[model samples]
Target: MKRPLLKIGELANLANVSQDTLRFYEKHGLMRPSARSEAGYRLYSAQDLQRIRFILSAKEVGFTLKEIEELLALEVTRDEKSCQDVKSLVDEKLATVTQRIHELQRIKKSLQSLSDACCGGDEPATHCTILEALSDHDAGSSLVGGKHHDLIK
Candidate 1:
């Protein structure tokens, strides 16, 4: 006879994620493991464990669950096209990382300037220079230079 299946809670504990996170992964198509319990509990397999680990690793590299699903789908196809697709995905991820790095560098410079301004003459928060710098001027007179507006938007 086979052993009984693990419930969602047990499987989630084993995978080092909350049960809700596992459900979210399933909902997002990053994981499509079978649900065998009619009472509506989620059942998991060994492959599910590996897939969860794969999701965690992908997240560490900044891949969204959508990206993970795309990558996993390609991997399962077992075709020469899989290699080409993975390469394309990696290239896209690299460009995203590079863009993020540039944005971070710009943010760092802005923060440094703000900090330096706030530190000038040891002014108190009630009259904070940084706060003054952050105030919205007339659009044509804004001091943000060329920083992208998406962060505020």
Candidate 2:
């Protein structure tokens, strides 16, 4: 029995994505339709549906589109080796996420310190510590770990 080819609308509906998103994926070569109808409408097969699902799943797991493209480029001919390769890719992504988390934490601390410096009282804005700190290039740079702490006035 032949599986019916799905039009772009049907595939987008089934995939829970907008038709424009499907076109975007297709335009990026991330997901290509298996064929086109005589009228030039994009047509997808069951395999295409699965591929789109994989791409979406990867994105949800924090894979950038370029990383997903690299993943898609990986040729897996054997199960054991393929599993190892996939694991390596996952490990790399995890490391990237961990580094990003650390950077965000540092930024969070800096922002909190800045916010704490402001009393939020009825005092004139001219005397605001937060504003003063911002205007002081040396102090501002040091807050973000720049090499200007020694230059603080």
Candidate 3:
């Protein structure tokens, strides 16, 4: 039996992505239509739909387009070593996310300290400690791992 092919718009609706997104994926070499109709419309197969879903899932987890391309290549190979390589890629992403979390935590602490320093008064901006701290060169250093121990005081 012959497999069914879906038009570009149909596939986009099934995938819940814009038709332009599908075209972008094609341009990036991440996806390809199974065939083109006589009317020049792009047509995709069930396999293409599966590939697109995989790409979207990878992107949701912070994989770059380039990385998704690598993953697609790896998926085709389907060996034990390929599985190991995929694990390594996920590990690298996890480490990056972990580092970003730490940096954000530090920023949150700094912002909280700055907020606590403010008296919340509606009087005038001239006497606002928050504004003063923001203008301080030393306070700016806190964003780059510099000491902010005295920021609250």
Query: Which candidate, 2 or 3, would have the higher TM-score against the true structure?
Result: 2
Clash count list over all predictions: 0, 0, 0
- What is model 1's C-alpha RMSD? 7.8
Over all chains combined, what TM-score does candidate 1 have?
Answer: 0.50
Query: Can you give the lDDT of residue 139 in candidate 1?
Result: 32
Q: Give candidate 3 misplaced runs (Cα > 4 Å).
A: 75-153
Candidate-wise lDDT, in order = 0.69, 0.76, 0.77
Regions of candidate 1 where Cα sits further than 4 Å from its true position: 1-4, 76-153
- Please give the ranking of all candidate structures by TM-score, highest first, separated by commas: 2, 3, 1
Best prediction by lDDT: 3
Which is superior by lDDT, 2 or 3? 3
lDDT of 2 at 150: 91
- Per-residue lDDT tens digits of candidate 1, residues 32-140? 6565678776787777788898889878767787877876775434577677877787788678778767655655655555666464545453324443444422235
For candidate 3, write residues 72-109 as lDDT tens digits. Answer: 77542468767787788767867777876776565565
Cα lDDT tens digits, model 2, 46-80, are 99999889999979867788888877876656688
